[model samples]
Target: MLIAQITDLHVSFDPAFLDGRVAPLEAVLRAVAVLAALDPRPDAVLLTGDLAENGSAEEYAFIRHALGELDLPVFAVPGNHDSSPAMRTGLGSFMRASEASHACYVVDDFPLSLVGLDTSVAGKAHGALDPARLEWLEKVLGQRAGRPVFMFMHHPPFDTGIRTMDACGLLEGRERLAELIAWHGGVVGVVCGHVHRSIHTSVAGVPTVVAPSCAHQIALELRANAPLQYRLEPPAIALHRCEQGQMMVSHVRYIPDFPGPWRF
Candidate 1:
């Protein structure tokens, strides 16, 4: 199975976002176009998080309409810039009913179980997996005992060494989450967004990845106490492919109209 991951769209009704530096809406549309044109289209599209810039209904509505062009199942989780309630209501068609109050749910229709975890904290930049949320995840993982589960969420549990981003990273329940994944032993991979750059690591011995933003990217600054800033870099998406007996493999596909395909 193949899955396409897009993240940090930050779609806003306002065309001039970030002081007119980038157009989040257009950026997402471009990403969508690329996904639509893929030769062998992905089985599903995972909207990791930050689907909107203001968490507004209008923004979500626009995104819904924009994504309607693709004939693929789209799964989404909430990010810091998103309002869970607003997203749930606006993108109801794309999301399934969750037993937990948070926007956490499991998709069982695919070969790989797709688990979406909610890490967005309302009105806060940081993310956390509180006891209740952790409990819900544990229950879900327990139920899917032997299935190869692929988890996706907004914030990454591990530190990226980018001090500013790490300061607001998954601040709670990471250790427990790691333990749960280790205990399950069926989790194939964990995918995340919100760092606005492609990063990879292992959590509980499972490969974990953070997809780059579709609009703007966080500047690669690792200096201590560096200020948080964004750059209008070429947007990108992540493609994850998994086969029966092989581990998942990931590739980063940049979304830009650059020259390519010339004979090497």
Candidate 2:
């Protein structure tokens, strides 16, 4: 099974977002076009978080329309910049109802089980997994025991060393989350998208990935007191391929019209 991951779109109705420094709408459209052109297209698309610049109705509507072009199953979770209520109402078709109040849910229709975690904190840039949400995850994993699961969320459970982003990273319940992944033992991988850059690590012996943004990315500043900054770098997405008895492999596909395919 092939699953495509697109994160931190930051799509806005305004073309001149971020003082016209980044064109998020155009960037996302290009990403979508790239996905559409894939030879063996991904079976599903995962929208990790920050689908909109602001959790506004108009922003959601615009993104919804843009993503509609894919015509493939899309799963999404809320990011810090997103409004849960707005997302549920606007992107209901892309999400399934969750037993918990948060936007957490699971998809079992494909070869790889998918668990989406809602790490967004209302009106805050940081993310957390409260008791209720964690309990929901535990229950889901228990019910799907022995299944190869791929968990996706907005905030990464580990620190990325990017000081500014780390300060606003998953601030709570990460320890417990790591424990859950270890205990489950069937979690194949954990994928996230808040950092806006492709990063990889391991959590509870499972490969964890942070996919790059489809729009601007956070500046790669690891300095001790560096201020938060974004760069209009090349946008990209992640593709995960899964097969029986093999570890899932992920690839980063940049969404730009760079010259390519020259024979070596």
Candidate 3:
């Protein structure tokens, strides 16, 4: 099955339309336009949060508008910019009752098993996966034993080499996640967002990926000592193709003419 990963929209009610130089509301809208035009389309759209620039109901409404055109099931988790209750009230309508009603859920089906983990903690710039979430993850992993499961969250369960962003990934409780991945042979890969850059690595010998922002990207400079740099580089989204009993492969595509107009 095909799965699309859209991360870090960072949507905001930009009362002042500052073009691409400011928060990328238009960039996100452009991304969705491209997503809607995909040839075969995705079975599901898995968003790894930062759905809003601030945890505001209006911003969630903005996200709702952009995501509304897609003809697919959308699954999301809370990022630092998302409000748990608000996200529940907004996106919960598309989710199943068994989805736990907290903007976190799992889809174990024909082509793949997706585990949506919520790593957002209230009023914090960083993220964490605590005991309760970990235990829930363990239970889901247990239920899907022997099946190829693809896990997703807003924060990488481990570091991403960039010091500043690394500090923001799962904190002390990461060991539990690592141990679980180490033990579970069915986990084919881990997909996460929040760093706003694409990273491919292996954690616990399992392939893990960080989906870049749909709105903007963090400078790849591994240090803040350098000149401040954030760019309007082409916005990107990830596509994962999964076939049972085979490893999943991902393609990160940049939507061109984004935040602009182009005719076919």
- lDDT (Cα, tens digit) per residue for candidate 1, span 1-264: 999999999998775677767778778889999999997999999998899999999999988888878978998999999998899899877777885468888999999899999998888999999998999999999999988999999999999999999988999999999999999998888999999999999999988999999888898889998888877767899999877766678899999862222211
TM-score, candidate 3, is 0.89
In model 1, which runs have C-alpha deviations exceeding 4 angstroms? 258-264
Which residue pairs clash within candidate 3? none
List TM-score per model, in order.
Answer: 0.95, 0.95, 0.89
Cα displacement (Å) at residue 218, model 1: 0.2
Q: Of the candidates shown, which would achieve the greatest lDDT relative to the real structure?
A: 1
TM-score of candidate 2 against the unseen true structure: 0.95
What's the candidate order when arranged by decreasing lDDT? 1, 2, 3
Off by over 4 Å in 2: 258-264
Q: Which ten residues in a row have the lowest lDDT in candidate 3?
A: 93-102
Query: Each model's C-alpha lDDT?
Result: 0.88, 0.88, 0.77
Superposed on all Cα atoms, the candidates' RMSDs to the truth, in angstroms, are 3.9, 3.9, 3.9
lDDT of 3: 0.77
Q: What is the alpha-carbon lDDT of model 1 when measured against the actual structure?
A: 0.88
Work out candidate 3's RMSD over C-alphas: 3.9
Reference-based lDDT, residue 122, model 2: 91
Ranking by TM-score: 1, 2, 3
